[model samples]
Target: MNELFDSVADGLVDKSYAIIDNFLTTDEVAQILTLPHFNQHEQLFKKAGIGKNADLQINEAIRGDYILWLDKNTAPPAAMVYLNRLNELIQHLNRSLFLSMKDYEVHMTVYPVGTYYKRHLDQFKKDDHRKLSVICYLNTNWKEEEGGQLRIYTDHDSFDVLPVAGRLVCFRSDVLEHEVLPATRQRLSLTGWILDQQIM
Candidate 1:
């Protein structure tokens, strides 16, 4: 809808960057097909042969709903609008707030019912490429008690970003430790890192 963002979005895509906010509306996200399959990816991790029912959460996730790899090229026009919005946000943070550009990558993550991700770091201490973390929640009709809050940890405090539709959360990917609490309702989000331009 705006000309200013076209260049900005292109810049961020070229350089690993950071910024966050409602990038995808609920209806916009539903365009991506989701199929149901049980522990289909277990064989991918068969080397471990995790015990039966021994909690196959992460191991089985690569199979849709549990975890879906978005075909960004197929995203709707709404996604383009959202990217422009993010470009604006990043400019605000950089010029007004003074956030440094670092190595990062952009991505989308979706979680369905009874799904949860354990606490993890955006980038490994040794591998510092993922410097900025951004998340945009796209699940409509979400409730606090539904329990899919993004637990973010800072030096002295921890905060939860409830998975509200159109809500976005951005933070230091390297310094922030976060997790997704299990949800009673289906929860969805787009999460990714922004890398540094100079690094490329």
Candidate 2:
């Protein structure tokens, strides 16, 4: 985990993003995916929407996916374990880079076959607290031909990141505009943001 922290901090400083594969092992990914909470509370998931507060609305044309926000206070055991691990990372990053990240918000995102999200930035105009975006994919047996790639746009060029199981993609929330390409197979991932404490 320390090694990952160093790598993440260095990557963020150098390029504002990092893509790491095998952050979680195959067996660990399978274990999380097989958790009963996903099956038992499937109905809790809802169609993903765009914007926030009054501006928030389901816009299928922009993003066709479903989401279940994970509650930090009431997450299931397996999920809690993962969150704790991430919290450690939050602390590590703060110590190393003083990012001012205080908490995190996460959700389970599912893109059904043929679904996709258009290019967009993660940070909204109303909120600057979202400092970093993190996506840990859990799609096993994914193939390039299946086409559910995460296309990240940079200043000079763009890159397509395959949604392979245990792959972790971290990036600046405000700087990069990205999109999810339509997939022939269903795609699953844990997506979230690292946030700074808002002054009240």
Candidate 3:
């Protein structure tokens, strides 16, 4: 586990991003999928908005996903397990990369068919506390034809990542410009940011 953390640290140092497959075990992913919010998503989840605070707005043309924020204290056992691992990774990153990440905020996201997020950066213009973006995919048996690929752009290159189950993608929140392509089927993932300020 320490070695895995080290690999993530190394990737940040080299490329400012990392894509790690099987970050969670099959059982772990299954447990997380059992979250009650997923079952009652229509009632519990809210439309994800762009911007923050006073500037926040729900523009379906830009993005069309529903999200439910997670609370560690109230999270089920499976979520706690995942959060504990994230805490460990946070500690390791602080020690190795000096990111100074004080806390993390995460939400379960569900993108209904034909919904997608337009190209954008994760960090806010006024507030830059969000240092890192992390996404853990939970869509099992996903296929290339499904079309829900994450497209990350760089200065001279661009690539797409399929939302495969148990795959973890981490990147600098302020640096990367990315977007989610519309999928023929629904897509599911746990998406969040590691922040420099404490919110937990």
Candidate 4:
């Protein structure tokens, strides 16, 4: 696990983003999928919105996904496992990069078929506390043809990442402009931000 953490840190230093495959084991991914929030997403999830607080708004044209925020205190054992791992990563990043990240906020997101989020940066205009953006895909047997790829735009180019189970994508929240592509099938994932300020 330290080796993996080192690789991610190195990627951030060299490039600003990293893509790691099989970050979670098959069993671990299956366990997360069994969580009540994921199984009952339709009932428990709320529509995702853009901006923060008073500026928050739900416009399907901008983004069309449902989200259920995860609370470690009440999370199931399987979910706790993932959260604990993230805590470890946070510590490693703080020590290695001096990011001063205080905590992470994550949610289970489900995008229905043919829904997408337009290109945008993860950091909000009024808030720059989000330093890192992380996503771990949970779609089993996902194919390129399925279409829900994350397109990240860089200074001179861009690239697409397929939403495959156990695949992890991490990038600088304030620096990257990215978007989700519409898919033929539902897309599921754990998505979040590593923040410099504590989230209350």
Candidate 5:
């Protein structure tokens, strides 16, 4: 309905690369989080302070669990906006790739400040459920030199994206192996995937 949201959707449909810049503004993000229809689901913000050891041990090919600190008391409006934009992006990508998004699962996740996930692929072993992955940056006043870039490894090339404000990175969930490096500052972002088919 707004210019920022419209722009992000259009941009994602146009680009199928690892990084997309200026995807969503902070102001636009706040709107989606506060909307009653979007906010009423009531299961989003729950969090647990689990240590990083278990997360790191997660196998790369095996489908991982929803491991994140979902700030139960906080409304990360930016995250919601990005996730909304991402769902649209997946649908567009599906159209291009001749896949239907409704046949799978989609989820929204967040990493705040020091939250870092080890290198992994979103697809599952013997499942092949995940097809596309998306990450949306929400930190404002972020520095490109702060070192919170996503490290994506491909057979032919490598890609890194600064956890800068209003950026969304999308790639094939199975092809791109990526990790969230440690940051010099607080890095906030939305991370998730669109599975190829529903396993549950």
Candidate 6:
């Protein structure tokens, strides 16, 4: 835990974002992916949409994926364990960086073949409580040619963050513009946000 916390903290302090490989162990990734919610509840993963609340709309051209939000009150044991880890990370960040994060939310996401998400910032006007964006990849044996990379843009340069197993990406939600490039195979990930107290 110390290793991960320190690495993430230092990365955020230095670049406003961080990409950590081996954030989860093989067993841990298996635990998350094999849960009944993911294995048996495929119907629950509704089509993802753009915008929030009243403005939300399903536009396949812009975003193409399915998502199943982890329910805080009813998440399975494996999920609860994962969420607990995130809670601990939140505590670490609040103590070390004074991020003042009050809560966290996560969802299991899947992008089928050829799916992709257009470039956009994580923060939205009406639901601006999102302070940080975190995503953990679950795909094993991923290859460069598979093509589902996270393309993050900065003022001077842009780079691709591969969706490889056990890899984690964290960034200031409002500071970066990123997009999911099209993939040749299925892509799976656990994604979430760290929110301020005002959102709770």
> Which runs of model 4 end up more than 4 angstroms from their true locations?
none
Give a tens-digit lDDT track for model 2, residues 60-154: 99999888888878987767766787788789889999778988998988888899999999998998899999998989999999999999999
Query: Where does model 2 exceed 4 Å of error?
Result: 37-42, 198-200
Least accurate 10 contiguous residues by lDDT in model 6: 35-44
TM-score of each: 0.62, 0.94, 0.97, 0.97, 0.63, 0.95
Candidate 3, residue 120: the lDDT equals 97
Candidate 3 stretches with Cα past 4 Å from truth are none
What are the lDDT figures for the candidates, one per model? 0.55, 0.87, 0.92, 0.92, 0.56, 0.88
Q: What TM-score, to 2 decimals, does candidate 6 have?
A: 0.95
Over 74-93, each residue of candidate 4 has an lDDT whose tens digit, in order, gives 87888787788888989999
Q: Rate residue 166 of model 1 by lDDT.
A: 68
Could you give candidate 1's per-residue lDDT for residues 80-185 as a string of tens digits? 4555555565565465436565333443455557767667676755556565677777677777888988887666777787877666666666676777788887
Residue-by-residue lDDT tens digits, candidate 6, 1-200: 77898788888889999898888888888888887655544577889999988999999999998999987779888777778878888889889897789998899999989999999999997878899999989999999999999999987999999999989899999999999999999899989999996443
| TM-score pick, better of 3 and 5 | 3
Write model 5 residue lDDT over 131-173, tens digit each, in one string: 6676666667777777777888867777777877667776776
* Model 6 CA lDDT for position 153: 92
* Candidate 1: C-alpha RMSD after superposition: 8.2
Q: Cα RMSD to native, each candidate?
A: 8.2, 1.8, 1.0, 0.9, 7.1, 1.4
Superior by TM-score: candidate 4 or candidate 6: 4
lDDT of 4: 0.92
Task: Kindly report which residue stretches of model 6 are placed more than 4 angstroms away from their true locations once superposed.
Answer: 39-42, 198-200
